[model samples]
Target: MSEQELKLHVPAVARRAVQQDIRQGNASRIRLRALYFDTPGRELARARIALRLRQEGRDWVQTLKMPGADAITRVEINHARPGPVLDLSVYAGTEVEAPLSAIKGELGLCYETDVQRLLRQVRSRHGTIELAYDTGVLRAGTLELPISELEFELMSGRPAAIFAVARRWQQRHGLVLDARSKSERGDALASLARELAALDADDPDAQVRRGTAITRFWAPRGAAAVTLDDTLTPAQAMGRVAAECLDQVARNAAVLAEVDTLGVYPAGQSEHVHQLRVGMRRLRSAWRLFDGWTAPPPATVLQGVRTHFAAFGQSRDQDVLNETVTPVLLQAGMPVITFEAPPVDIDAQAIAAGKAFQGWLLDALEWSLDVQPPSPASAPEPMAASDTAPEPAFRLDGSATAPAITPTIIPLATEAKPQPLHKLLGNRLHRWHAKVAAQGKDFATLDIPARHDLRKRGKRLRYGLSFAESLLPKSRLRGYRKLLSEVQDRLGEINDLAMAKDYYQACVGTHPQAWFALGWISARLDKLIAEAQQAFDRLADTKPFWK
Candidate 1:
């Protein structure tokens, strides 16, 4: 391909402060370039499955691929195009040089003001990947913080096949696709190399160690500058204002255009309908956490978003199953006609319901975004923006005091009272594991939504048990944690699919013709439930990691 493009929506704080120097123009823009290789599949590429890299600028700003067996694709999309040519050609490589040769490609379009365009590019990629690369580009866009991003990739079996793939990729992914060449990960990689070259590492082998330390310690902290009309400090009001601005813009854009694609674009346009669903979740979380601090958004507004999110979520899933999963299963050697009945039909209803739900979501997104604030300056505080600062060193009464927070100490005990870290972890694991197991069992007895809620609670407990194991030493408990995570992931997918199907079915029944189309889709969902059950069984076979 002549050029490949990656659009990344980093948070606004990525911009530098007025105080920082800018010898390389502003860091507001970065450049990147790298070569993607099919590692295991090629002989000249014996390293098999490695994406060779090269780049420019501060090495601290670039990113590195995790060296491993599952490194599927190594992509670099940065703020600037061809930023790495000089560095890649002259500086990169070791005893066995893995240098990259850049192809002639131009930087594509720059959507200077549209954040949603960026997010759409990303979501499109995820959906397309599942469908197998068919000369198409995926797009994900959004208007939320961290800013939204969209990527257009040209996947070709031959090096000379890039341009055709690029052209087709854009049409399939989105019409407005920019042919801009940018590396998402290139700038990070280049920055890292630059630092390594200048490092005073006494031991050559410790390069990785030094790089990690520097990046972790010196990573820039992003902050938004807010000048309040009143005496409140910038910290006190920045996050809230930013979030409110984002919310306003997002709501106005929620009534997704007939042409606008969600997760699985075009074929399954409503796929990202789940965002609205998840937004409802975040909204609910916001209500739970912020209602006492600030009056919550109106109940009608909240209800509208919640209802639509739930509805569209169902339809979106059904669309995916019928359009994506069923085809996948059939391709994977499953007999389509063998498994057909109640669950299948039921799942179809879920699809129709999903469409209806999506309609509601469009309305809710509008409501949430279009909400008129009490006053231009009265938005709630943006908690995340300021949460990273060192905890304030003052007491609530306006007095400065060093309130003591105890450190967790691991005491060394002799053989007589030796406490194994594994044993301690196991004890916590046992408690949390049992709680989750009990919750899972309890879920069966609950009604539809209640059952779903119980499953969610059980899932959280499962994650809690797994987290405990990580904080402890390697032991049988750790194994159990792995098993728990696997089982949780499997069960969660199944339950989500089932619930979505059920919800869709109920909604679609109202539209008879849509119901028939949904019915065909419903058949595929039954298979999904079975697949999820089978996954859970596999998970169950593994002995729990606890001892």
Candidate 2:
């Protein structure tokens, strides 16, 4: 049978509170001791199959489970008997039967979990949900790890109820959604223990891969990442985009945490930082694209994400200054008086911020899954005609000039009846193209702020295109992406120079070496500005892929 459930990782401190909350309602407490089995070579684990004999009260039940369609669902088979014993007959016709038969005699106890489980049934508008709060310890030989989690299973209703209840608890207690299963964690621990034992018994000439030591410290790998289905509707496509972005954020955060814990990367070489920032930007872009259509998280959550992004940004900025900008100045025959890098603890701070952001992203994903798509009757109206007019041009001093060109009206999908995703995406792309084309007309006349705004538009356009890339022609999409990338690179260089100038000015009072750097950067600014203008012009000239 298929089982649908959601698992949340609860902090040890909050375990009692969750249990107490369950106790206040209709809940039953049960003691459970489950012994997980695997072959000497871990054949079942390799096949993503788990076999456990669980003791509940006076009865023993053997259960086998494997991943279903997604992380929240599983295929489970159970057999209850008077005593715990290997039962090969229970797997007669299942997918795991062949694998189990081959390892029948080799199956042995790998790990065991002793948990105090509190069970409760919740009734809501969507349906009934069975909430299980488990707290205990997982044991593998001499190794032990604490386990505390809350599982919500759909008993007799829509999957939406599980998220609804989860959101309530998350809002109240800050519970983090977890995708790891007990069997997975146990298997990981056992493997790690065995590996360590082998290393201890090996020759001194043995070689270890770099970064292998920290693998166990990071978060467990989640279920297979979500992918966008080509046949999805506009709303469904947006959801898939959000899911993919969330997965990116989680995966990057895990890597960032590992990097921070290991302290392996030097300044300017932090791939984790770059990837994490990209993940956040992609997430923010998706949020912007679907803001009104999807229910947003609380303002505080959004602000928290912004704060974390800024924290990472700060570290990254200093890294660029030290690694990229400083060399340029020296090569240009400019004397550097002082270049101060960010504090050493920046990576650690970034990791902490990332963890908080990951928690919020997971919560947001859960919320998004339960969000109701707007029906045709309640859909939003298209953009106003006046809103399609070209924005006024700005001079280098930031003063606005008269409008020179009129932009084409781009109709957007409404909540009542969203247009086909392909059409909606095309219109959105056209709107972005129009804005970029309008802005790029007088790129040479724009000030730092105006150019920055244009750069942000380019970024948004690029990210937006990514959501529809699968549906678009691959060759055309690739060319458009490359063009967008070139424009962004040039704008980014201009912004960096402008920032370096500002930093030099700020350091004048504290560092005597700022004068030469300022002069060098001032000389380079005009060349960068011209380059940026040309890049934007090229982007404006390129035909829209959506066309």
Candidate 3:
């Protein structure tokens, strides 16, 4: 049978609360003791196979599980008997036959789980969900770890309903999403136990601590290497961009989780949070640039990413208010009353959201990998451009300079083959560059909304260049990126000032103490606008690196 389920890690302290929420009808409580087996080298584990024998009252059940078509789905086979014993005959003709037969003799007990399982069924709008709460100890020799988690198994419903319920629980209580199964966690713990034993043998008096220790170092997985050749098609380039962006998202999420786990910060610093947000923005930009090239990720997946980004942004805003704005006001002798911030455990919240986002990214990566390249006939249409032609050359100050070397444009060979990556990227870069330059031409006279749109255009250009950085010349690319950053920084400052003034204006009516901060921000708004204009002019004068 194929099982679809979502597992969430519940803290021991929140056990009672979660149990109470599902305590409406009569529930069956039973004791479960499962013994796991693997080879000395854990061949089955490496093969993604799990074998376990569990005792339930007077009966014993042997279960075999392996990865299914997707992450949330699993292929499970169960064998029930009156007593516990090794049984390989049951797998006579199944997929597990060959592997289990070969490793049968070498397999031995690796770890054991003793837990009290509470089983109940809850009805949702879509269908029924089997709720299981397991609490006990996972034992591997002398090492033991607590296991308290809530598993929601979809008995009959769309997968979306399960996720919806999970989200509600997540919002109400800070339950982290853990995709690792009990067997997986046991395997990891068993390996850790062996490593610790080796260390203890080397140094008998070496002190070993237990229970959720901080990770000292973390090396995130990097994106797959993409080497462009003359044969590379535009569709292939789009796939590479998608793959790289997904990889970036996964890597940043890993870093954020590490930071949250270690809780390493000085007062109100959150560099990881800021970096993760940037990664999300870059991923979103990549999606926009190649929207029609392939199938989009599920709406739920994208929404989940946005939800996490918003949560992280809230934490970041609070950090800025406490660390930056509050100090500035204090130094200026402003009484900042009614500065109310949420009593949030920012690190914990970030960790939960990061895990959820990372899970979605993994799903996205899998989906992207499965996408077949589109034929030339099905290629996306060329993007539309303004009727007015762009300037022939860019001027740094008053002197105009043409590009040192023009890009080589490759024409499409036939309707069956897509355009070359180099040509497609060059055209897109030119369009983005012209759009930004045209918008910035009247920066000082444009309204706030128009300037904001220009800022977004500049950002899109910057992110697109970053995606194709390997294709561009190094020297020119560095200068172009630097100039773009300068413009973005200035525009960001102006926006931040406007937001601060609005925030203070809203608070001043209620507290009256924020009037001084509001007046101070209002006085600098015009100067900031002028600075933004100069920055935009500099950006407009810079040439596109791809040229």
Report the number of the highest-lDDT candidate: 2
| Per-prediction TM-score to the true structure, in the order listed | 0.30, 0.66, 0.53
On TM-score, the stronger of 1 and 2 is: 2
Clashes of 1: 71
> Model 2, 523: alpha-carbon shift in Å?
6.7
What global local distance difference test value does model 1 have? 0.36
Which sequence of candidate numbers ranks them by lDDT, best first? 2, 3, 1
Write candidate 3's Cα lDDT for 1-547 as tens digits: 9997877667655679888876766678889999999987989998899999999866799999998754467999999966779686899999888877767448889999999888888778977788898888899877776787888888998765566566666556556565568998788768767666656445535554322121222233333444454475545555566666555554455444432233443211265566656767766776766566655666765786788778768766566666666677778888857556668856733453444654565455545544444433666666555533445676768677764654669897765565566666767788888888888878889888998888888888888777777777878888878878888887876777676777778886688888888877776678777877787788778776575
- Highest TM-score: which candidate? 2
Predicted candidate 2 versus true structure: per-residue lDDT over 1-547, tens digit per residue? 9998887766544667888899999899899999999987998999899989999977899999998754467999889967988787877987777877777547889999999999999888999899999888998877676777889899988877877777777556656555568998899877766665566436554445213642544433332333454366645666667666665555555444432223443222355566656767877877776655556655755786688777777667666777688888888776656444455857632353233654565556665455445543565787897976676799999999988975669799665765566766777778888899789878889877888888888888888887767667788778777877887887888788788888889988888678888887877787877876777777778887675
